[model samples]
Target: MPKPVLIVGAGLSGAVIGRELAEAGHVVHIIDRRSHIAGNCHTARDEASGVMVHVYGPHIFHTNDDEVWRYVNRHMTFMPYVNRVKTTSAGQVYSLPVNLHTINQFFDRTFRPDEARDFIQSQSDPSIGEPVTFEDQALKFVGRELYEAFFEGYTRKQWGCSPADLPASILKRLPVRFSYDDNYFSHLYQGMPEHGYTEMVARILSHDNISIELERNFVRSDAGDFSHVFYSGPLDGYFDYELGRLGYRTLDFEEFQYDGDYQGCAVMNYADADVRYTRVTEHKHFSPWESHERSVCYREYSRACGPDDEPYYPIRLSGEQALLAQYVARARFEQGVTFVGRLGTYRYLDMDVTIREALDTARSCIRAFADGLPLPAFNIEP
Candidate 1:
């Protein structure tokens, strides 16, 4: 009999890969350090309010990939959700992404979309030829006033660094709209799972060939027991951080229950640096499909990740990238193991992209296994 494949971490990456491999006739064993599944996207019902709360943080699944969208829908019902974020800045409320409504409200003008665009163009600094830093990109695109109000304070609080120090790529992800389109994500399919992410993951791992164990940690020695190992833990931790610790920013959530509505929206950005926490998320707003008298909210604080903290976002600055390169080199030389997922690859990934990569990775692995070839250390570069 062939040995069962070992999958470390019962998150989306492991679950998707395991499901695909199981369907391909491979027995799979998946484990996670946490008591629950879905990793950071874990959601559970608030016992008192019966509101399905995002335990770690809010995760609204949005994707452009039809295959990925269809795959998730096969497991759980997803209700249509549009994330319209709001921001509190300079003692006034504003729509996020600096849309036409936000610009008009901020400047107290009734300019049309075209006039607004031309006005913004005049506000933008033309001196910046090729933007390098995040500050430069913001100023070149949206001008100082909008940058200061929207990106500056919020970015500093979220990353624990000035926008001037961050790369331009960071600010490029956010889009500035001339119209009143306040939807945070521009993806074609945007929704929340009906039951919750945990339930969806549970359904994905329900096949007879896949067995799961929670609250079980994966160490280096466990690799020998399986035919091949799909490791979704931190790449540095695989070697026990022998080289050095990579930099990461971890989140501290101040969870509180409210008798009624806390915030009108799912997410509210506190753009002022003095505000301390980056944003306050009202979990009830995340699932509009359900009704609840009480609400669950989290005041999210971002800080430098310590050894004991759960790493949220990887700080891929030059210094961290140097250390990551060392870890990547070591990972490449390691045998019989493949590193995958956010922590495994040291990259922040949206749920849709994670699932897409998992599906592709599984197909690649199945093909290699059939051809009696060695598996690559990573499906992507770290």
Candidate 2:
């Protein structure tokens, strides 16, 4: 007596849940609007360059969660990837995340550990007890100089708005180290999937009972056969935005092939507002193990996600949360339906976070069935 399941949107979150349920002996059916399994993490090798380019953009996998790290490694071998992010800001290129090297390079002073700490402390604004805005938080941590140089313009470019309007929680960590540690991530485990994300997802979804339909027309009424329907598509689209549309930011990546090496690094962020394009990613470097004679490059651009734009980041504007509440309320009232993952929950999530959340959600569902606990509409809170 296996419970039939219907999962929409074959993204990482949906894939994770669908796979888990099928492994637990539940019949599962998964569908995606796109022709691929991996949502944004999809990677395909360019036939011309022999370079595995991130179709959406470069996604660097970095996380401190040990369980998540082990889970992903079980499927694919992860290679070492150090995100030495270089940024062009104020007529000069510098290392990002405001490490010791960046501090030294920008200030034109060879400051030792103590000197750097004291110098930075001198520049930081002490008056602000609690940070209220992105600008306030950045200045409080990295000071006016670094904030202005590194974050201000980049934030503007990425958000298509001023940092001053953004929430302080965004600057949770600026990573000011005493040592000259320029490594971007402080995670215990960090690397890219050996076979790329598409394969990783393909591995996750490979099961006897699970059937995946790609580039399929998804109508909510069409999913009536299943006992429980898991919706991972846009929450608005899920409910047809009975209330109103939630705000979001989308990316526009302009790509081209280069004869040889275009940029030495995999990621070069344009922190200064002077550059029209925010960053140039050389996809070849992402796969350092495989040497490509030629290279592929993508100039990353940020813009407002219009009605038709592929929404990347959830804006969560003032009344949007209330609007989200309306959707959640409607979802709760609906029978045999669970809303999980980024789009369904109306929040941006990293791959690792999405995977972990899906795993936990699956476990929660199984436990709920065993212990007679109630299953939630959401796997994770927004």
Candidate 3:
């Protein structure tokens, strides 16, 4: 009998890789430190409200990759979901992404798309030829008024730092739409799993050759047991933080239940410096397909990740990036192990991207085995 491949972390990365390898005639053993699967994307039903709550905030799967979209759909049904984000700033509500309608409403004028575009251009900082920081990017893209109202406070609270301290790439993710499209993502396929993310992941790992163990903490020494070990845990944790811990921002969700609708929306950003929490997410609105009289919500608070805290977002500042490069060098020298997933790579990856990379990683592993070569430490660059 051939030795089984060991997979540490039963999230989408581990699950997808395990499924693919199993289908290709490899016994795969998956394990996660968390009792449940899906990692941060874990979703479950609230017994009190009967609403499917995103245990660690909401995760709406949106992607342009047809292969990844079709792959997930094969396991479970996906309900169409368009994320229309709303923000409250200075006692006024507004649409997110700073659309044309938002511009007109903010200034109380009927400006056409062209007029709005020209007005924004006039308002932008002409002195800033190149944006080097998050603050510079916002001022250059949307001007001061819109940036202050929509991004400044929210960003400061979310990242626990001044917008100026962050890299310009952080604000580049947000788009300034010319039209009144409130949809958060431009992906062709966007939806939430019909049952839940956990169920979808569970179904994916239901192969005869794949065995999953929950609450199983994996260590570096465990690599001796399997033919090859695919680790999806934090890269720093894998090396016991010998090069010092990589900086990460963790979240604190203050969950509360209310009768009827709480905010009448899935997510509402509190874009005021006085507002302690970054945003409040109403779980019921996440799955509009289901109706519920009571709603569950979470007021999200962001802070520096402690040793015991679950890391949510990687803060890839200059210092952290330098430290990561050292770890990457160390990882390359490590044998019989490959680091995979968001935490392993120390980057913020969406659900679709995670699945796509996992699929590609699995294919690379298979090819390496067939060619009588060792698998590389990372299929996707960190």
Q: lDDT of each prediction vs. the true structure?
A: 0.93, 0.85, 0.93
Per-residue C-alpha lDDT of model 3 across residues 1-382, encoded as one tens digit per residue: 8789999999899999999999999999998999899888899999998999999888999999999999999999999999999999999999886898899999898998899999999989889987899999999978999999989999999898999999999877769887999898889999989999999999999999999899999988888889999999999999999889999999999999998988889999999989999999999999999999999999999999999999999999999999999999999999999999999999999999999999999998999998889999999999
**TM-score between candidate 3 and the true structure:** 0.99
Model 1 Cα lDDT, one tens digit per residue, 1-382: 8999999999999999999999999999999999999999999998988889898888999999999999999999899999999999989999887899999999999999999999999999999998899999999999999999988999999899989999998877658889999998889999999999999999999999999999998988988999999999998999899999999999999999998998789999999989999999999898898889998889999999999999999989999999999999999999999999998999999999999999999999999999999999998877
What would the TM-scores of all predictions be?
A: 0.99, 0.96, 0.99
Candidate 2 error regions (>4 Å) = 1-3, 370-374
| Residues 1-382 of candidate 2: C-alpha lDDT, one tens digit per residue | 6457889988888888988898888889998889877888899989898889899998889998898898888888999988887888877888766767788899998999899899999999999889989999988888998988888898998888899998887777667886777777888778999889899889988899899989985787966787778888888887776677887888998989988898789888888888878899999888888888898999999898888888888987667778888878887777667788888899888887888889998888877766766677776766
What residue runs in model 1 are displaced by over 4 Å at the alpha carbon? none
TM-score: the better of candidates 1 and 2: 1
* Worst 10 contiguous positions by lDDT, candidate 2: 366-375
Model 1, TM vs. native = 0.99
Instruction: Give the lDDT ranking, best first.
Output: 1, 3, 2
